[model samples]
Target: MAEGDGVVKSAGRVLGLLQVFAEHRRPMRVSEIAQAMGIPQSSTSMLLKTLTAMGYVSFDAEAKAFRPTLRVALLGAWLNEEFATEGSVDEMMVEMARATADAVILAVENGVWSEYIHVVQSEQDLRYALRPGTKRPLPATNLGRVLLAAKPDDEIERIVRRINAEAAAGDRRFDVATTLDAVHAIRRDGYSFAHNLISSGASVIALPMPVPPGYKPMAIGIGGPTDRLERGQEMILAEMRRLLSQYLGG
Candidate 1:
């Protein structure tokens, strides 16, 4: 393999390892981390040892578990002042989740996919478990469509075509014209909503978040069962709008 390819692969594994800790929010054994990352235990142990030596991760001998150190949290803490303040995106997501009793997700465009960077699980018993690091095709999800709405038509079409070109035969393919129409609707309406488009009996309502300069485009979404989301659409939209205006001033 090329040296650059190896570097990128290693970087992705480090980020994925950090994300596993973020998802579980607890110290994890080597076996647990390996299983979560779908990597070999030996590799996981080596990675953990490297991180420990770098002072980015800590290992507890008594518990035989590893956890990210404060240095890891400090790495990106200065990137966004808003994130360090009271009226943060994190706070808004929590409020939205509480108000709607549904899953709230913060997604960012990652290559041709929309990746959920943060997810507040629904309080409702019947809801699905949407975890952080979940990814979906950029042109095929409401959350993704809202992120795409921030881009120009030409870029959207290019991205759609690329997604189609790379997709396997059995995988879903996107129609450029159809995707453009959907993105246009999202732009006109200032939000996107879809029911049962990606998952059966599931609905998602999403709006583009105000991205800071030099930051990737992002969208915040609320998701739940179709019937419940449909019934509470108005209320949910109102809450979302209020929170966005209050916290993000958008």
Candidate 2:
């Protein structure tokens, strides 16, 4: 869909507007977008019309709104197995959850964001309920911090600033120096853990997976109530390393 030499170049803008659609909870009206983002109503209408016709969005003629379609998830699914390594990370996640009785998540950096692509819930009825495709801010959780800390310093600062802009001013537990020190420690020690950063009773421990040559593998985290993970984080960390190594090779 490349434009001619001198025609126009709003395709990027159109795609960006569609991305905005993915993050929203409810279908948006042209006026709602115009007021919310300062974009013009006619432009929004045109973009919505194009998106609806392309099957990326569904138009509610009765409600007069445009909603995202299943196409996006289908597109993402087509690429998951391509990116994931062939291993027992899934099996290890389940075993870890059962043995530790803690919820476990398989996460990987997807471009600028980190996604929880798989989950194994703890057996207890009180355990946290997590699902596939859970996305969260990278700086707000230990899982994000572990991945962020592994990035280059300049990149890490840029991400930190972005997270700060979206975060409340008073919520000031993390800063560059302290976070960098934490990252250094994780890299040296080969695992990351945190308690009560995202939820009060929640604790998390993450370890990097050995990915294939020329491909970045991923990191998986075990999370549950601090009371349980605290009593067993060290043991879980040990077992995960041994099991992951068996599949990935030590």
Candidate 3:
């Protein structure tokens, strides 16, 4: 094979090693990665050591296994989105925060959950306690559901099945069929609103917002007590649509 071909093959091996750490957050030994990825143990050990040298993996002395470092899994995405959107999303999120006065958040789908990237505080004493890296289930929050609604049917089915399996394993609370129906409803509705559905006396409305090409998508949310954003739903969505258009257009 050519030099370029060899480089691509090496990259594929490195990425495969990276994926072996993604099934869960725990570390795995070289023998485990070899079996999981169908690569040879000799190659897996060498590749893992290479990744460790690159600051992407660590051989945990206590666990006696290779684990991905925060730096290793960091972009773990297709590519960086910051450069793609040119930073206009920050302004749009702030605009939503100012317009609603309820908590306006920017989030993205992380597995079957939504991860907050930014959050604007609500004036009400009651607020959802979520940090930037916090992960909330798709069925529990409007933000997570809107993202699930945007996914293709097959992807949606897979997520639903995983939810059910987790529920059966006693890790979650809802069935797959009900969750799939909810995702479909959110897609048809274009936005979703629910009050006290997941938490008592807490209300949240979220709409999936578009982003520029080459950028990962986001959602805008207005959350507070049931009465707070109820009156402003239509207005908030309309403003979100406008801001999305402006950022993606120019």
**Candidate 2 lDDT, tens digit per residue, 1-250?**
1234443658645545554553344788778765544567888788778877889888787898777888855666634354434344555666777766778887777655677767777778778666555677665667777777668888877777776766676754448776777778888888888678777887788887666656644677888777877788779888777767665564
lDDT of 3 by residue, 1-250 (tens): 1114346878777765654564333788778888877878998888888878988788888878988887953563333253224334555666766766767777887777787766666655666644454577776778887887777867877877776676644566756677678778887888878677666776778887765456565676777777656777677777767666665442
Best-fitting candidate, scored by TM-score: 1
For the record, the alpha-carbon RMSD of candidate 2 to the native fold, in angstroms, is 9.0
- Candidate 2 or 3, higher TM-score? 2
RMSD of each: 3.4, 9.0, 11.4
Residue pairs of candidate 2 with colliding backbone atoms: none
lDDT minimum window of 10 residues, candidate 3: 78-87
Give the TM-score of each candidate.
Answer: 0.83, 0.60, 0.59
Model 3 quality (TM-score): 0.59
| Alpha-carbon lDDT, every model | 0.87, 0.70, 0.69
Error of 1 at 203 (Å): 2.2
Q: What lDDT tens digits, residue by residue, belong to model 1 across residues 1-250? A: 1114346877878988998887777999999999988888999999999999999999999999999999998787665464423456766888989998999999999999999898888867899578787789998899999999988999999999999999998999999999999999988889998778888999799988876678899999999998988899999999998888777777
